[model samples]
Target: MKLPPLKTLPVFEAVARTLSFSAAAEELHVTQSAVSHRIRQLEDDLGESLFDRHGRRVALTEEGERYLEAIAPALAQIERASQQLRGQSDTRLRLAVPSSLAVRWLIPRLPHLQRRHPDLDLTLEMLADMPVMSERLADAFITIRYRQRGYVSTPLYVERLFAVCSRQYWMQMRESLEDAGLREKGSGRSIRPEWLSRFTLLSAASVFEKPGEDWRRWFQAAETEMPPTARVQQFSHMLLAQEAARHHQGIALSNDYMLDTASDPELVRLRTHEFRTGDEFHFACKQSRAKEPGILHLSRWLERQAEASGWR
Candidate 1:
């Protein structure tokens, strides 16, 4: 049996699904006239009118409804098959991740990920911690705490906050204390809680002001108060603030999940106190795409990586 023009089927499907010639035309990037012409041509080929039209309104006929139900899945399958033949089925995965996490964590582990999935094309986009609901933004997003409604979210790790500074800076503090004979004579090194105000506080744009993750929260957890006049330098993102802390510019509040423990010898955590904000990293995507092999495979790999690194 000969098939009708292959191109018209997509146009027919678009129109039947939308029930609007203009809408189909907009989606197909063509004119309303083109959509009408295609539908009319498709009807002529099948010897059946697929829609009932009045003015700007339209509805699928009984035959159109049946045809849509039949062909939609077939078209999707064809598209997937074509992608597979072209080596793109499960080959490309686009991910949006927090900038800090991308830099300090994901990028470092990416080589291992690439080795494990050599054929997979991974595109990473750095996004700040914000609510992104549109699926068009990314195939999946890795974020902290926030999950867009209607998306399937897989937990990665709950986070802990720490005060971090460069070894050089910590040594300087110790030296200054020793010169003044204020250093406690022992291996124990703990800065006084009030000393936090003496050092500049470097902060990320969003997390620093977040209710449960901010300077106020950390100080509250420590049973202290941030000095009202404490010198604070705010960066547009956490990665920037972290870099500043690495250079001994100031003390930065670091998220455990976003820290590269093995790599940053310059930075040291001031284990004087710790804070947990109850926020966690999550991998989220549209529910319809959650069970796709690519998504599931990557999610499992991420879970393992996080667990192995004690990130979870």
Candidate 2:
């Protein structure tokens, strides 16, 4: 039995949906000429004109209308079947996340996610902050939601603020415990809040695109004032600033979710109470897409990971 060129159907669907060859080409990430060629090829095989071309516009002929009505559902079924064979109804899930979370949290857990889902394809798009989801961009986003709406949001975990430094810094200060003004608390040394002025501060702007997520808030929670003349090194992305602190560059103000306690033994959290920020990490997706098998699988997996992260 003769089958239509498998590739042409998708091109035809794009053109039929948009009613413009150029638009279909842009959506398919191909040249306009390529779209025209596929349409011509498909029409030749079917022995009927699918589109009636006018000066600068095109319209579907009666044959095209009938053909599309029959094939579109079949194509959709084929896609669904392909996904089912791969273990999910939506095989590829495009997820957007903040850069710091991607580096520190998500990437590390991806191997387990892949093993569990097997056939699900997870594409992560790292952004400094979450953006609005679109068909051409991310299908979902994981970040702290402020006022953004129009999607189903599932809260994963709340982020709290803490100060961390390199283990080397802790050791060096221990050697000069008296001069560094370190105090003993229970079984560990703690830095005096006022002594913060002696060390360089590593910081990042709020990854949430809002203000006040910085060292100042951590100090404010302790009811201590940050020295006006304190030295600071600012990084655009929180991941970089956190890495700087891990490498002994300076003290960094970090969020709970961004700290990977299992892997990095070189970093030490300051012996101070943590500040709970009202913001939280959430998985945002279109209400329609949320029910898809792949989306559901990933959303559940992420929630479980968040639970294990000890921040919930």
TM-score, prediction 1: 0.69
Against the reference, the lDDT scores of all candidates come to 0.78, 0.78
lDDT of 2 by residue, 1-312 (tens): 899898999999889879999999999999999999999999999999999999669899999988887787577657777877887656687788888778777897899998999989989888864555543457678867623645788888787877888999866655565554465433465566767667788878664343334877777778987778888887766777889988889888777667765577788887766777677778888675678788899889998898887755
| TM-score for each candidate, following the candidate numbering | 0.69, 0.70
lDDT of 1 by residue, 39-136 (tens): 88889999988999898899988988877766875775587678878876655777898887787788888999889977768899778656554544
- Native-vs-model 1 lDDT? 0.78
lDDT of 2: 0.78
Candidate 2 lands at a TM-score of 0.70
